[model samples]
Target: MRFIKRLIIGFVMVIILGICLYCYARLIEPNMLLKKSYSVTVPKDVKELKIVFFTDTHFGKYYPQEKITRLVDFINEQKPDVVIFGGDLIDSYNRDQELVNIEELSKSLKKIKASYGKIAVYGNHDYGGGAEPIYEKVMTDGGFKILRDSELTLSDLNLSIIGYDDYLLGSVDPNRYQLPDAPFRIVVTHEPDVIDNIKANGSLLVLAGHSHGGQVTIPFMKGVLRPGAEKYIKGQYDLKETITGCDATMIVSEGIGMTLKPFRFLNPPNIVVVSLKHK
Candidate 1:
């Protein structure tokens, strides 16, 4: 009986510790982002441009509109030449039109800025109850170009930015996009698993954000659950020569929202600032 009591006490202590750490990381980490820099080794001669990529802002019961606004403030301060959102921007699911989660986000997210351009795709959570229309509208009103398995070229730099439709939605053919003979090209998607969805010529770099870094990662065990991605489910990873031998840098941001339980343990919301220094 004494042993069982001890075990229960130990478990409660651990939970307390975990919550405390998450709060510290989120509230005090000045920069909640786990920043990464990558060099697009391909296409050799383009001027370097910095990009701030982030994803998965499941702003609902767990995270709110005010929380996302805080994140937007941090990201804009980075002054990225280009900004990209990987996916899962909202999480209301449309079951209730009266929920203020998605609606508030739609109103508050128009404050972000990107010099070259801002682009994004939608995630599974962003498909229901008119989430897409509202999300796309908010982004467009904010001056961002919403890419739906489409590409746009920033004439000033000639870089083509493409957005691949979420694989969970339907089929995506990477071949549809003809990478222009430009200096740089990039692709944004919600889940990193879409690395296989690149049936067409892939971009120089791909950004994603569906795995919340396991949300509540443990000391020696994996997160209680996985949002997406099976292997190397940490925060960031580099997928070199794949089964197809195509080489493009792949980055998976840990993301800035919580899901299921709405409490993050070791995983803090990220606001990544990626500086592209191609050599």
Candidate 2:
């Protein structure tokens, strides 16, 4: 009789715990924001640069547009020289288009100040749900240069930034586009796995987002992998041999928003601050 009683109590306790976890994941955790920082070494002659990178902010029903104010505030506090947005500005342009305020969104984005310039690339979500035109217009209105399968050279900083189209929805033919000759190069993309197809002779730094760190990570297990983010999910990876047998360092952000799932457990929204220093 005692054994049965104890079993019943244990079952009830488990049920209670589950309910608590569900509430936390849904209400408390998703709103939490985190800041992740990384440092990279550049050539001696290259000027040091501070770059703030963020992505995967599915700003729609799940992620409210008002949160952009907080995002811009957090980014400005970092005092970045260059700001790079990885994409997915809105969650679903088709379903949530009417809900978003383009004018206010553009105003908040414009407030984010970057000394050198602001750069952005398309994401899978950006091209999905007829979001291509809206995404481009918003970023451009916010003073961002949208780079699609092209490279932008900052002669003053002697730095080159290569932006690619979304691998899942947009064109990403590395063979068709020529790489810049700048001594320092930074590549930005929505999906990290695209690194496998890019062929560069020298070392490069790649920044990406879209994994959302599984959106709900469990202990001792890997985060849920997305179609385009199978190999590289989150954090930093050093690849000795890429497409052209060149070395590259990649940092994948967890991102600052949610998508299909509205809850965030262990993985919260985040922005990455990269400090590039002279070697």
- Model number with the top lDDT: 2
lDDT of 2 at 243: 42
For model 1, how does the per-residue alpha-carbon lDDT over 11-121 read when each residue is reduced to its tens digit? 999999978777765554323545555545545455577888878877665566566667777788888898888777666656434545544555566677787777877
Which pairs of residues have clashing backbones in candidate 2? none
Predicted candidate 2 versus true structure: per-residue lDDT over 1-279, tens digit per residue: 999999999999999999999999899888887889998988876689899999998998899998998999999999999999999899998989787988888889999999999999999989997788788899999999999988898988888888999989998885734553445589998999887776675668899998887888888766688988888888999876554545579999989888887888888889999999976
Deviation from native of the Cα of residue 170 in model 1, angstroms: 4.7
What TM value does model 2 have?
A: 0.95
Backbone clashes in candidate 2 total: 0
Candidates' C-alpha lDDT? 0.67, 0.87
Choose the strongest candidate by TM-score: 2
Superposed model 2: Cα runs more than 4 Å off: 176-182, 243-245
